[model samples]
Target: MTQTANRFHRWFAEPGPRPPLGTWLMSAAPSTAEAMGHCGFDFLVVDMEHVPIGVPETASILRAIAGTPAEPLIRLAWNDQVLVKRVMDAGGKTLMFPFIQTAEEARAAVSYTRYPPQGVRGVAAVHRGSQFGRAPDYLKTANDQVCVILQLETPEAVERLDEIAATPGVDALFLGPGDLSASMGRIGEIAHPEVQGLIAHAARAAARAGKPIGIVGPNPEMVGGFLGMGYTFAAVASDMAMMTGRAVEWLAALQGRVQAAEPAAAY
Candidate 1:
């Protein structure tokens, strides 16, 4: 493992004063990757599950983040072994697995991240994770340095959260509000009273278990709300959304000024 990967590993074991803030960067564009790193976020979650980022493109994006301090995280589409190993092989140190609902899933995630007694992650230090195939201590250190985060997105997951948290090698628990709300029969209403209550309950459980929790909200208001509720890590927004929102607002303002100027000129 590289020093950067070791840093994230230490973060989990020692814990930190403040939970780092990151933004989700789903667009596979190299420019998007560079912009996300330059935006000053502590980390960036590269979306592989929903986006069309194949292995090669993902590697390029990771390279794009090389000069910046912001860490690159990949959210694998599913809990498949091939996908997990591929991401790790391609220089991914932190991974967010989706809809992990049971201890078995947690164990599987751990197994895929490690080698031997720790896991069955293929033994090959010849990837970007090993500094383009050359971290001498890669095998001995990879397991210890990887950060494994699981998404709790269903009612069943909420009920079994304690067990999941207790599962060894599970670094963090993240809440997928949209899916959680939908599972609770309140689709698209994450802020509904009952939904909020459920979130609070889960947060309390995670806090008591001493595992960091993560969330994604569009703006500071929602980010503040999650942090105030005891969530350790939070993603304030997405790269795509941030860019689109700024562009739309700027265009609207410019068009409004143009319309006003047109009326005055007609006088």
Candidate 2:
């Protein structure tokens, strides 16, 4: 495959003048992925962890995203080497490994993305990551270019934020606001002041360790709060949220029109 800069990795290593913003891709639709790519997001998370989207479907979504400027960062169901290998071979330059509650799990996640000596990923010269045997130095350079983002979903993960952020080969840290809040007995209450405080604290820990942090929220307001808290990258919403939100608005507006018409027709 032909070689190109890893946009996600570049942003993490040296964020430019503007903050990078992204969105979640839980729709599992290539059209949806492609539409989001053109909507000016800096990146997108192809959510495999909870979306029921498998590797094959992810590849199609990735392909759809490949046509646009926004880069794709896939979240795996787990930090297993097999899953990492499959995602990497399927041409995912950035991988987000979720539910990593400890530094050791974080380290293992990093290892799963790299080849032997640096990681445990098996070499595959003929893989899509190598551009189907086209990226001449893929084997030599893939390790350096592939970005690893570990997730923080529980209180335990937050407590170990410093160590996890400092782990070698971890390109960045992503906070999962939903699960983190759920773990705190505030299920589905990411905006709960206590949950927000924890997220802010995690941001501080990551910043102190000199690591970049990323996070997601259901809407722009919540995501904006996260951005204000020193998160380098933030995802404001998901494909599902955007789609259904607009659909709901449409129904409400149409209902209002019908209600107004009924009153006028009573004459």
Per-prediction TM-score to the true structure, in the order listed: 0.95, 0.97
Q: Which stretches in model 2 have alpha-carbon errors above 4 Å?
A: none
Candidate 2: pairs in clash: 1-131, 1-134, 1-135
In model 1, which runs have C-alpha deviations exceeding 4 angstroms?
14-17
Candidate 1 local lDDT, 131-209, one digit each (tens): 8666778778777788899999998998999999999998889999889999999999988999888888889999999
lDDT of model 2 at residue 97? Answer: 91
lDDT of each: 0.85, 0.90
Top TM-score model: 2
Error of 1 at 256 (Å): 1.2
Please report the TM-score between candidate 1 and the true structure: 0.95
